[model samples]
Each structure stands twice: as structure tokens, then as C-alpha cells.
Target: MKGYYQGFLIRDWQECDRNNAANILHSVLTEYGLPWLPTGADKDVIKVEEFYLATGGEFWVVEKQGKVVGTAAYYPVKRGEKAVEIRKMYLLPEARGQGLGKYLLTELEKTIENKGFREIWIETASVLKEAVKLYESSGYQAASGVETPRCDRIYVKYLPLE
Candidate 1:
């Protein structure tokens, strides 16, 4: 599938046998963040790997040209309840402005709704204006007065499974 931008592909993190997961994380921390860091952040990478391995959460990679250009994760917030948290959503710098983020989000919402989740919640830093816009346009509403130490905005959208 090299050089092809077919609809975003979703697969298990472990299924990414080419170490794209690590590349995805490094890209997010370096290319997308404030400052690029040296490739010696082994501890951070291990921590994320451990979480991915231990949780019931699922990680998905978005590929274009056979390269993992984006990633996202979803995990249950409460057992036996239709609630989940969307986290660690990242896309490579070269992959932005192509509506791939929105595509991933739409896929996630549909998947959650199909799985009986009544609502989907996400938290994003206030500085990420594009993300805020994506969420808002996708029917997510700003959560009033809700605050988290790591993020300035929290949004929620209800999925009606009729």
C-alpha cells in the first residue's frame, strides 16, 4: 500500500510489526511538539509500551504509503459500562491538513457507538486549536467548567444507538 492514501487503516498496536508504534511516538514528541528531543527517551517509550500491553485499551495506526502517519487509542473508563476515554491522538506533521484526524475521530465514534458506548469523551490542550475545531465540528460540545491538570479543554459527545 505504499504511496496510497486509501481510507485510514485501523489495526492493533501489536500488529504493527515494523516498529511503527515507536516511530509514531517519536514523531509526536519531536516533530509535532514544541521542541524535538534526542532519540534517547527510552524511559518514556517503555512506559507507553507497558501501558499498551497491559490495558484493555486498543491502539490504532493510520497508514499512508505504508508508513504509520497517525495513531490513536481508546480505553474503557468503567467496566461493563458504555464509557471510554480517547487518548494519545497524534498525527505526523506531514499528515496534517488532510482531514485524517477527523476521519480517525469519525471511525472511533462509529466504533464506540457500535460497541454500545453511549458517550465519548476527550481532553485536549487548549493550544491545539485544530483539535478543538475537529471535536466541535464532530458534535462534541465543550464541557462547562471541567478542568484537568494536563489539559485546558474537555469535550463530550453522546452517541445515540437507535
Candidate 2:
């Protein structure tokens, strides 16, 4: 389902959105001194819907007048797992501070929660203090054990009980 929030539009990713989504992902990551593209990055960009759709997952983009300004995605951390990991939750500088990050995350969390995911996991570099703040502000707790050297921090949020 596509949605409009403030002046931006949020929609399920389309094949045509590959470059726009990739550019946003590349620019945001590198701005924090992180690499532009991770291994197999193109698979997510080029086959976004294909990669996530069959697995009870989703990838979305926020666009302003047809240009991607932000992106967020969720995929199963592993087969038959109750936990889902968030990825690419980045917004351009122009789109920051307007509650867009929270908006994207809130939407994803709700969708995943409804899908019976017990918890959501997020990984981020310690250098991105603002991102850590945002995730913590949204009820994520610092989880022990780094999932990878690529990101030094991991956060987890258990879904609410029924």
C-alpha cells in the first residue's frame, strides 16, 4: 500500500526505483564514513520486491516528487525466524528532523508486528549517535553481542503482547 505523509510519498519499492533507492542508500552510508555499497547491495536495489516479497517482508521508499528521499526495508534475519532485521533506514539531509525516520520505522514495525514477528533487530555503527538515539527513543534497547563488525551496536525491540 502506498501512503502520503506530509509532502512525501511512501510506497512499496518498484523495479524502476532501483537507482533512486541505491543512490540514497549509498549517499547516506558514505556520509557517515561507511562504505558506499555493501556486498550484494545491487540485489536489494535491483530486485527489491522480488527479494523480499516472497518471504513475508517488505521494502519501501519515500519520495518527494518522484525522487527517492528516504528508504527502509525489513527481511527475515534467517529462514523460519521470529526476528526481523531492519535495513537501509536512511533519509537525506533535507528529509531529516521532520519525523520521517520515525514515520518509516513506525510503519515497518507495525507491519512486521502484525505479521507475528516477535522482535525487531537493528544494527548500526556507534559513530551514528543520532541514529542510535532515534532507535532508542523508539523503544529499542541495546542488545548484547554485535552481529557483525560492520556495525558495532545492535538494538532489539520486543513486540507488544496481545
Candidate 3:
């Protein structure tokens, strides 16, 4: 959960990284004209430990030059048998178009599969075109029942059982 990817350190979230991670999520949402919805869609960003770590999930922060620039997390969900939902995957504007997003996602999938999760779900808005493309190209199939209020598309990738 801790390594360097293209000069950015990807590691597990810590108590000290709360504000920086939240700001990265908020900034990315705002850049895409999306609502923050702290009480709804983003409630977990403020309580990563309770919602993710405590629930047998993981939350990670990407740091460059000692500053948090991106966030990625996932939590076990009841949507499907042995499933998890990828959440809070966002990056600051300056951090986009650098292959970091794809790298983070690949790492996430590897970790999730290694942890015995068979299905990985993602819910995202169409406004985030880059994200939609990334998911589509990465073998995620379109699905329904997006639970997030701000999300309009849902995708699911089934990993081969080990």
C-alpha cells in the first residue's frame, strides 16, 4: 500500500492526510462542475477510517513533493457476491493526463483481487469523460443501479477467481 509511481507516492491514508485528501476530491469534483455533497456522496471522504478502513476496506492518498494530489478508495459492498465498490477516485487538475489515474486503478484492481474480491464496481458521472473512458477501456462493463446521487453510470468488472 506504499510505493512510488512516477514520482508520486501512493500509500494508505493517514489521520494527517484527511484534509489534503478531502481537498483533492473537492477540487476535482468542482473542476468537473460536480457537487461536493458532503452529506451525501462525500460523507465517506470526511470519515475514511470509519467508512473504509474499519469496514475492511482501504483508502489511499497519492502524494507528490510531500503534498497530497489524488485519492482512491474502496469499500466492501452488498451489491454482489464478494463485491467491492471503488470510491473517491479523484485527482487534482494538475495531476491528470499523466497516466497516474490508470496506474492507480491497476494497482487497486490487483489489490482487490488479491484480497479475494470477485467483483469490482464503480459509479461515476458522465461529466467525467476521462473516467468513463478509463473504465470502459479497462474491461469494466456498463451496469445499472448506481447508488450515488451524483453518479449516472455504473460499471462492474468481474475478476477471475483465484
**Best of the candidates, lDDT:** 3
The digit string of per-residue lDDT tens for model 3 on 53-134 reads: 9999999999889889999999999999899999999998778899999999999999999999999999999999999999
Question: Global CA lDDT of candidate 1, please?
Answer: 0.66
lDDT of 1 by residue, 60-128 (tens): 777766677777777666522477778767787788898778877877777777777787888777667
Greater TM-score among 2 and 3 belongs to 3
RMSD to truth, every model: 4.7, 2.1, 0.8
* Evaluation by lDDT, superior candidate among 2 and 3: 3
* Each prediction's number of clashing residue pairs: 1, 0, 0
Cα lDDT, model 1, residue 43: 30
Give the CA lDDT, 0 to 100, for residue 63 in model 3: 87
TM-score of 1: 0.73
Between prediction 1 and prediction 3, the one with superior lDDT is: 3
Cα deviation at 116, candidate 3, in Å, is 0.5
Off by over 4 Å in 3: none
Candidate 1: residue 83 Cα off by (Å): 0.9
TM-score of each: 0.73, 0.89, 0.98
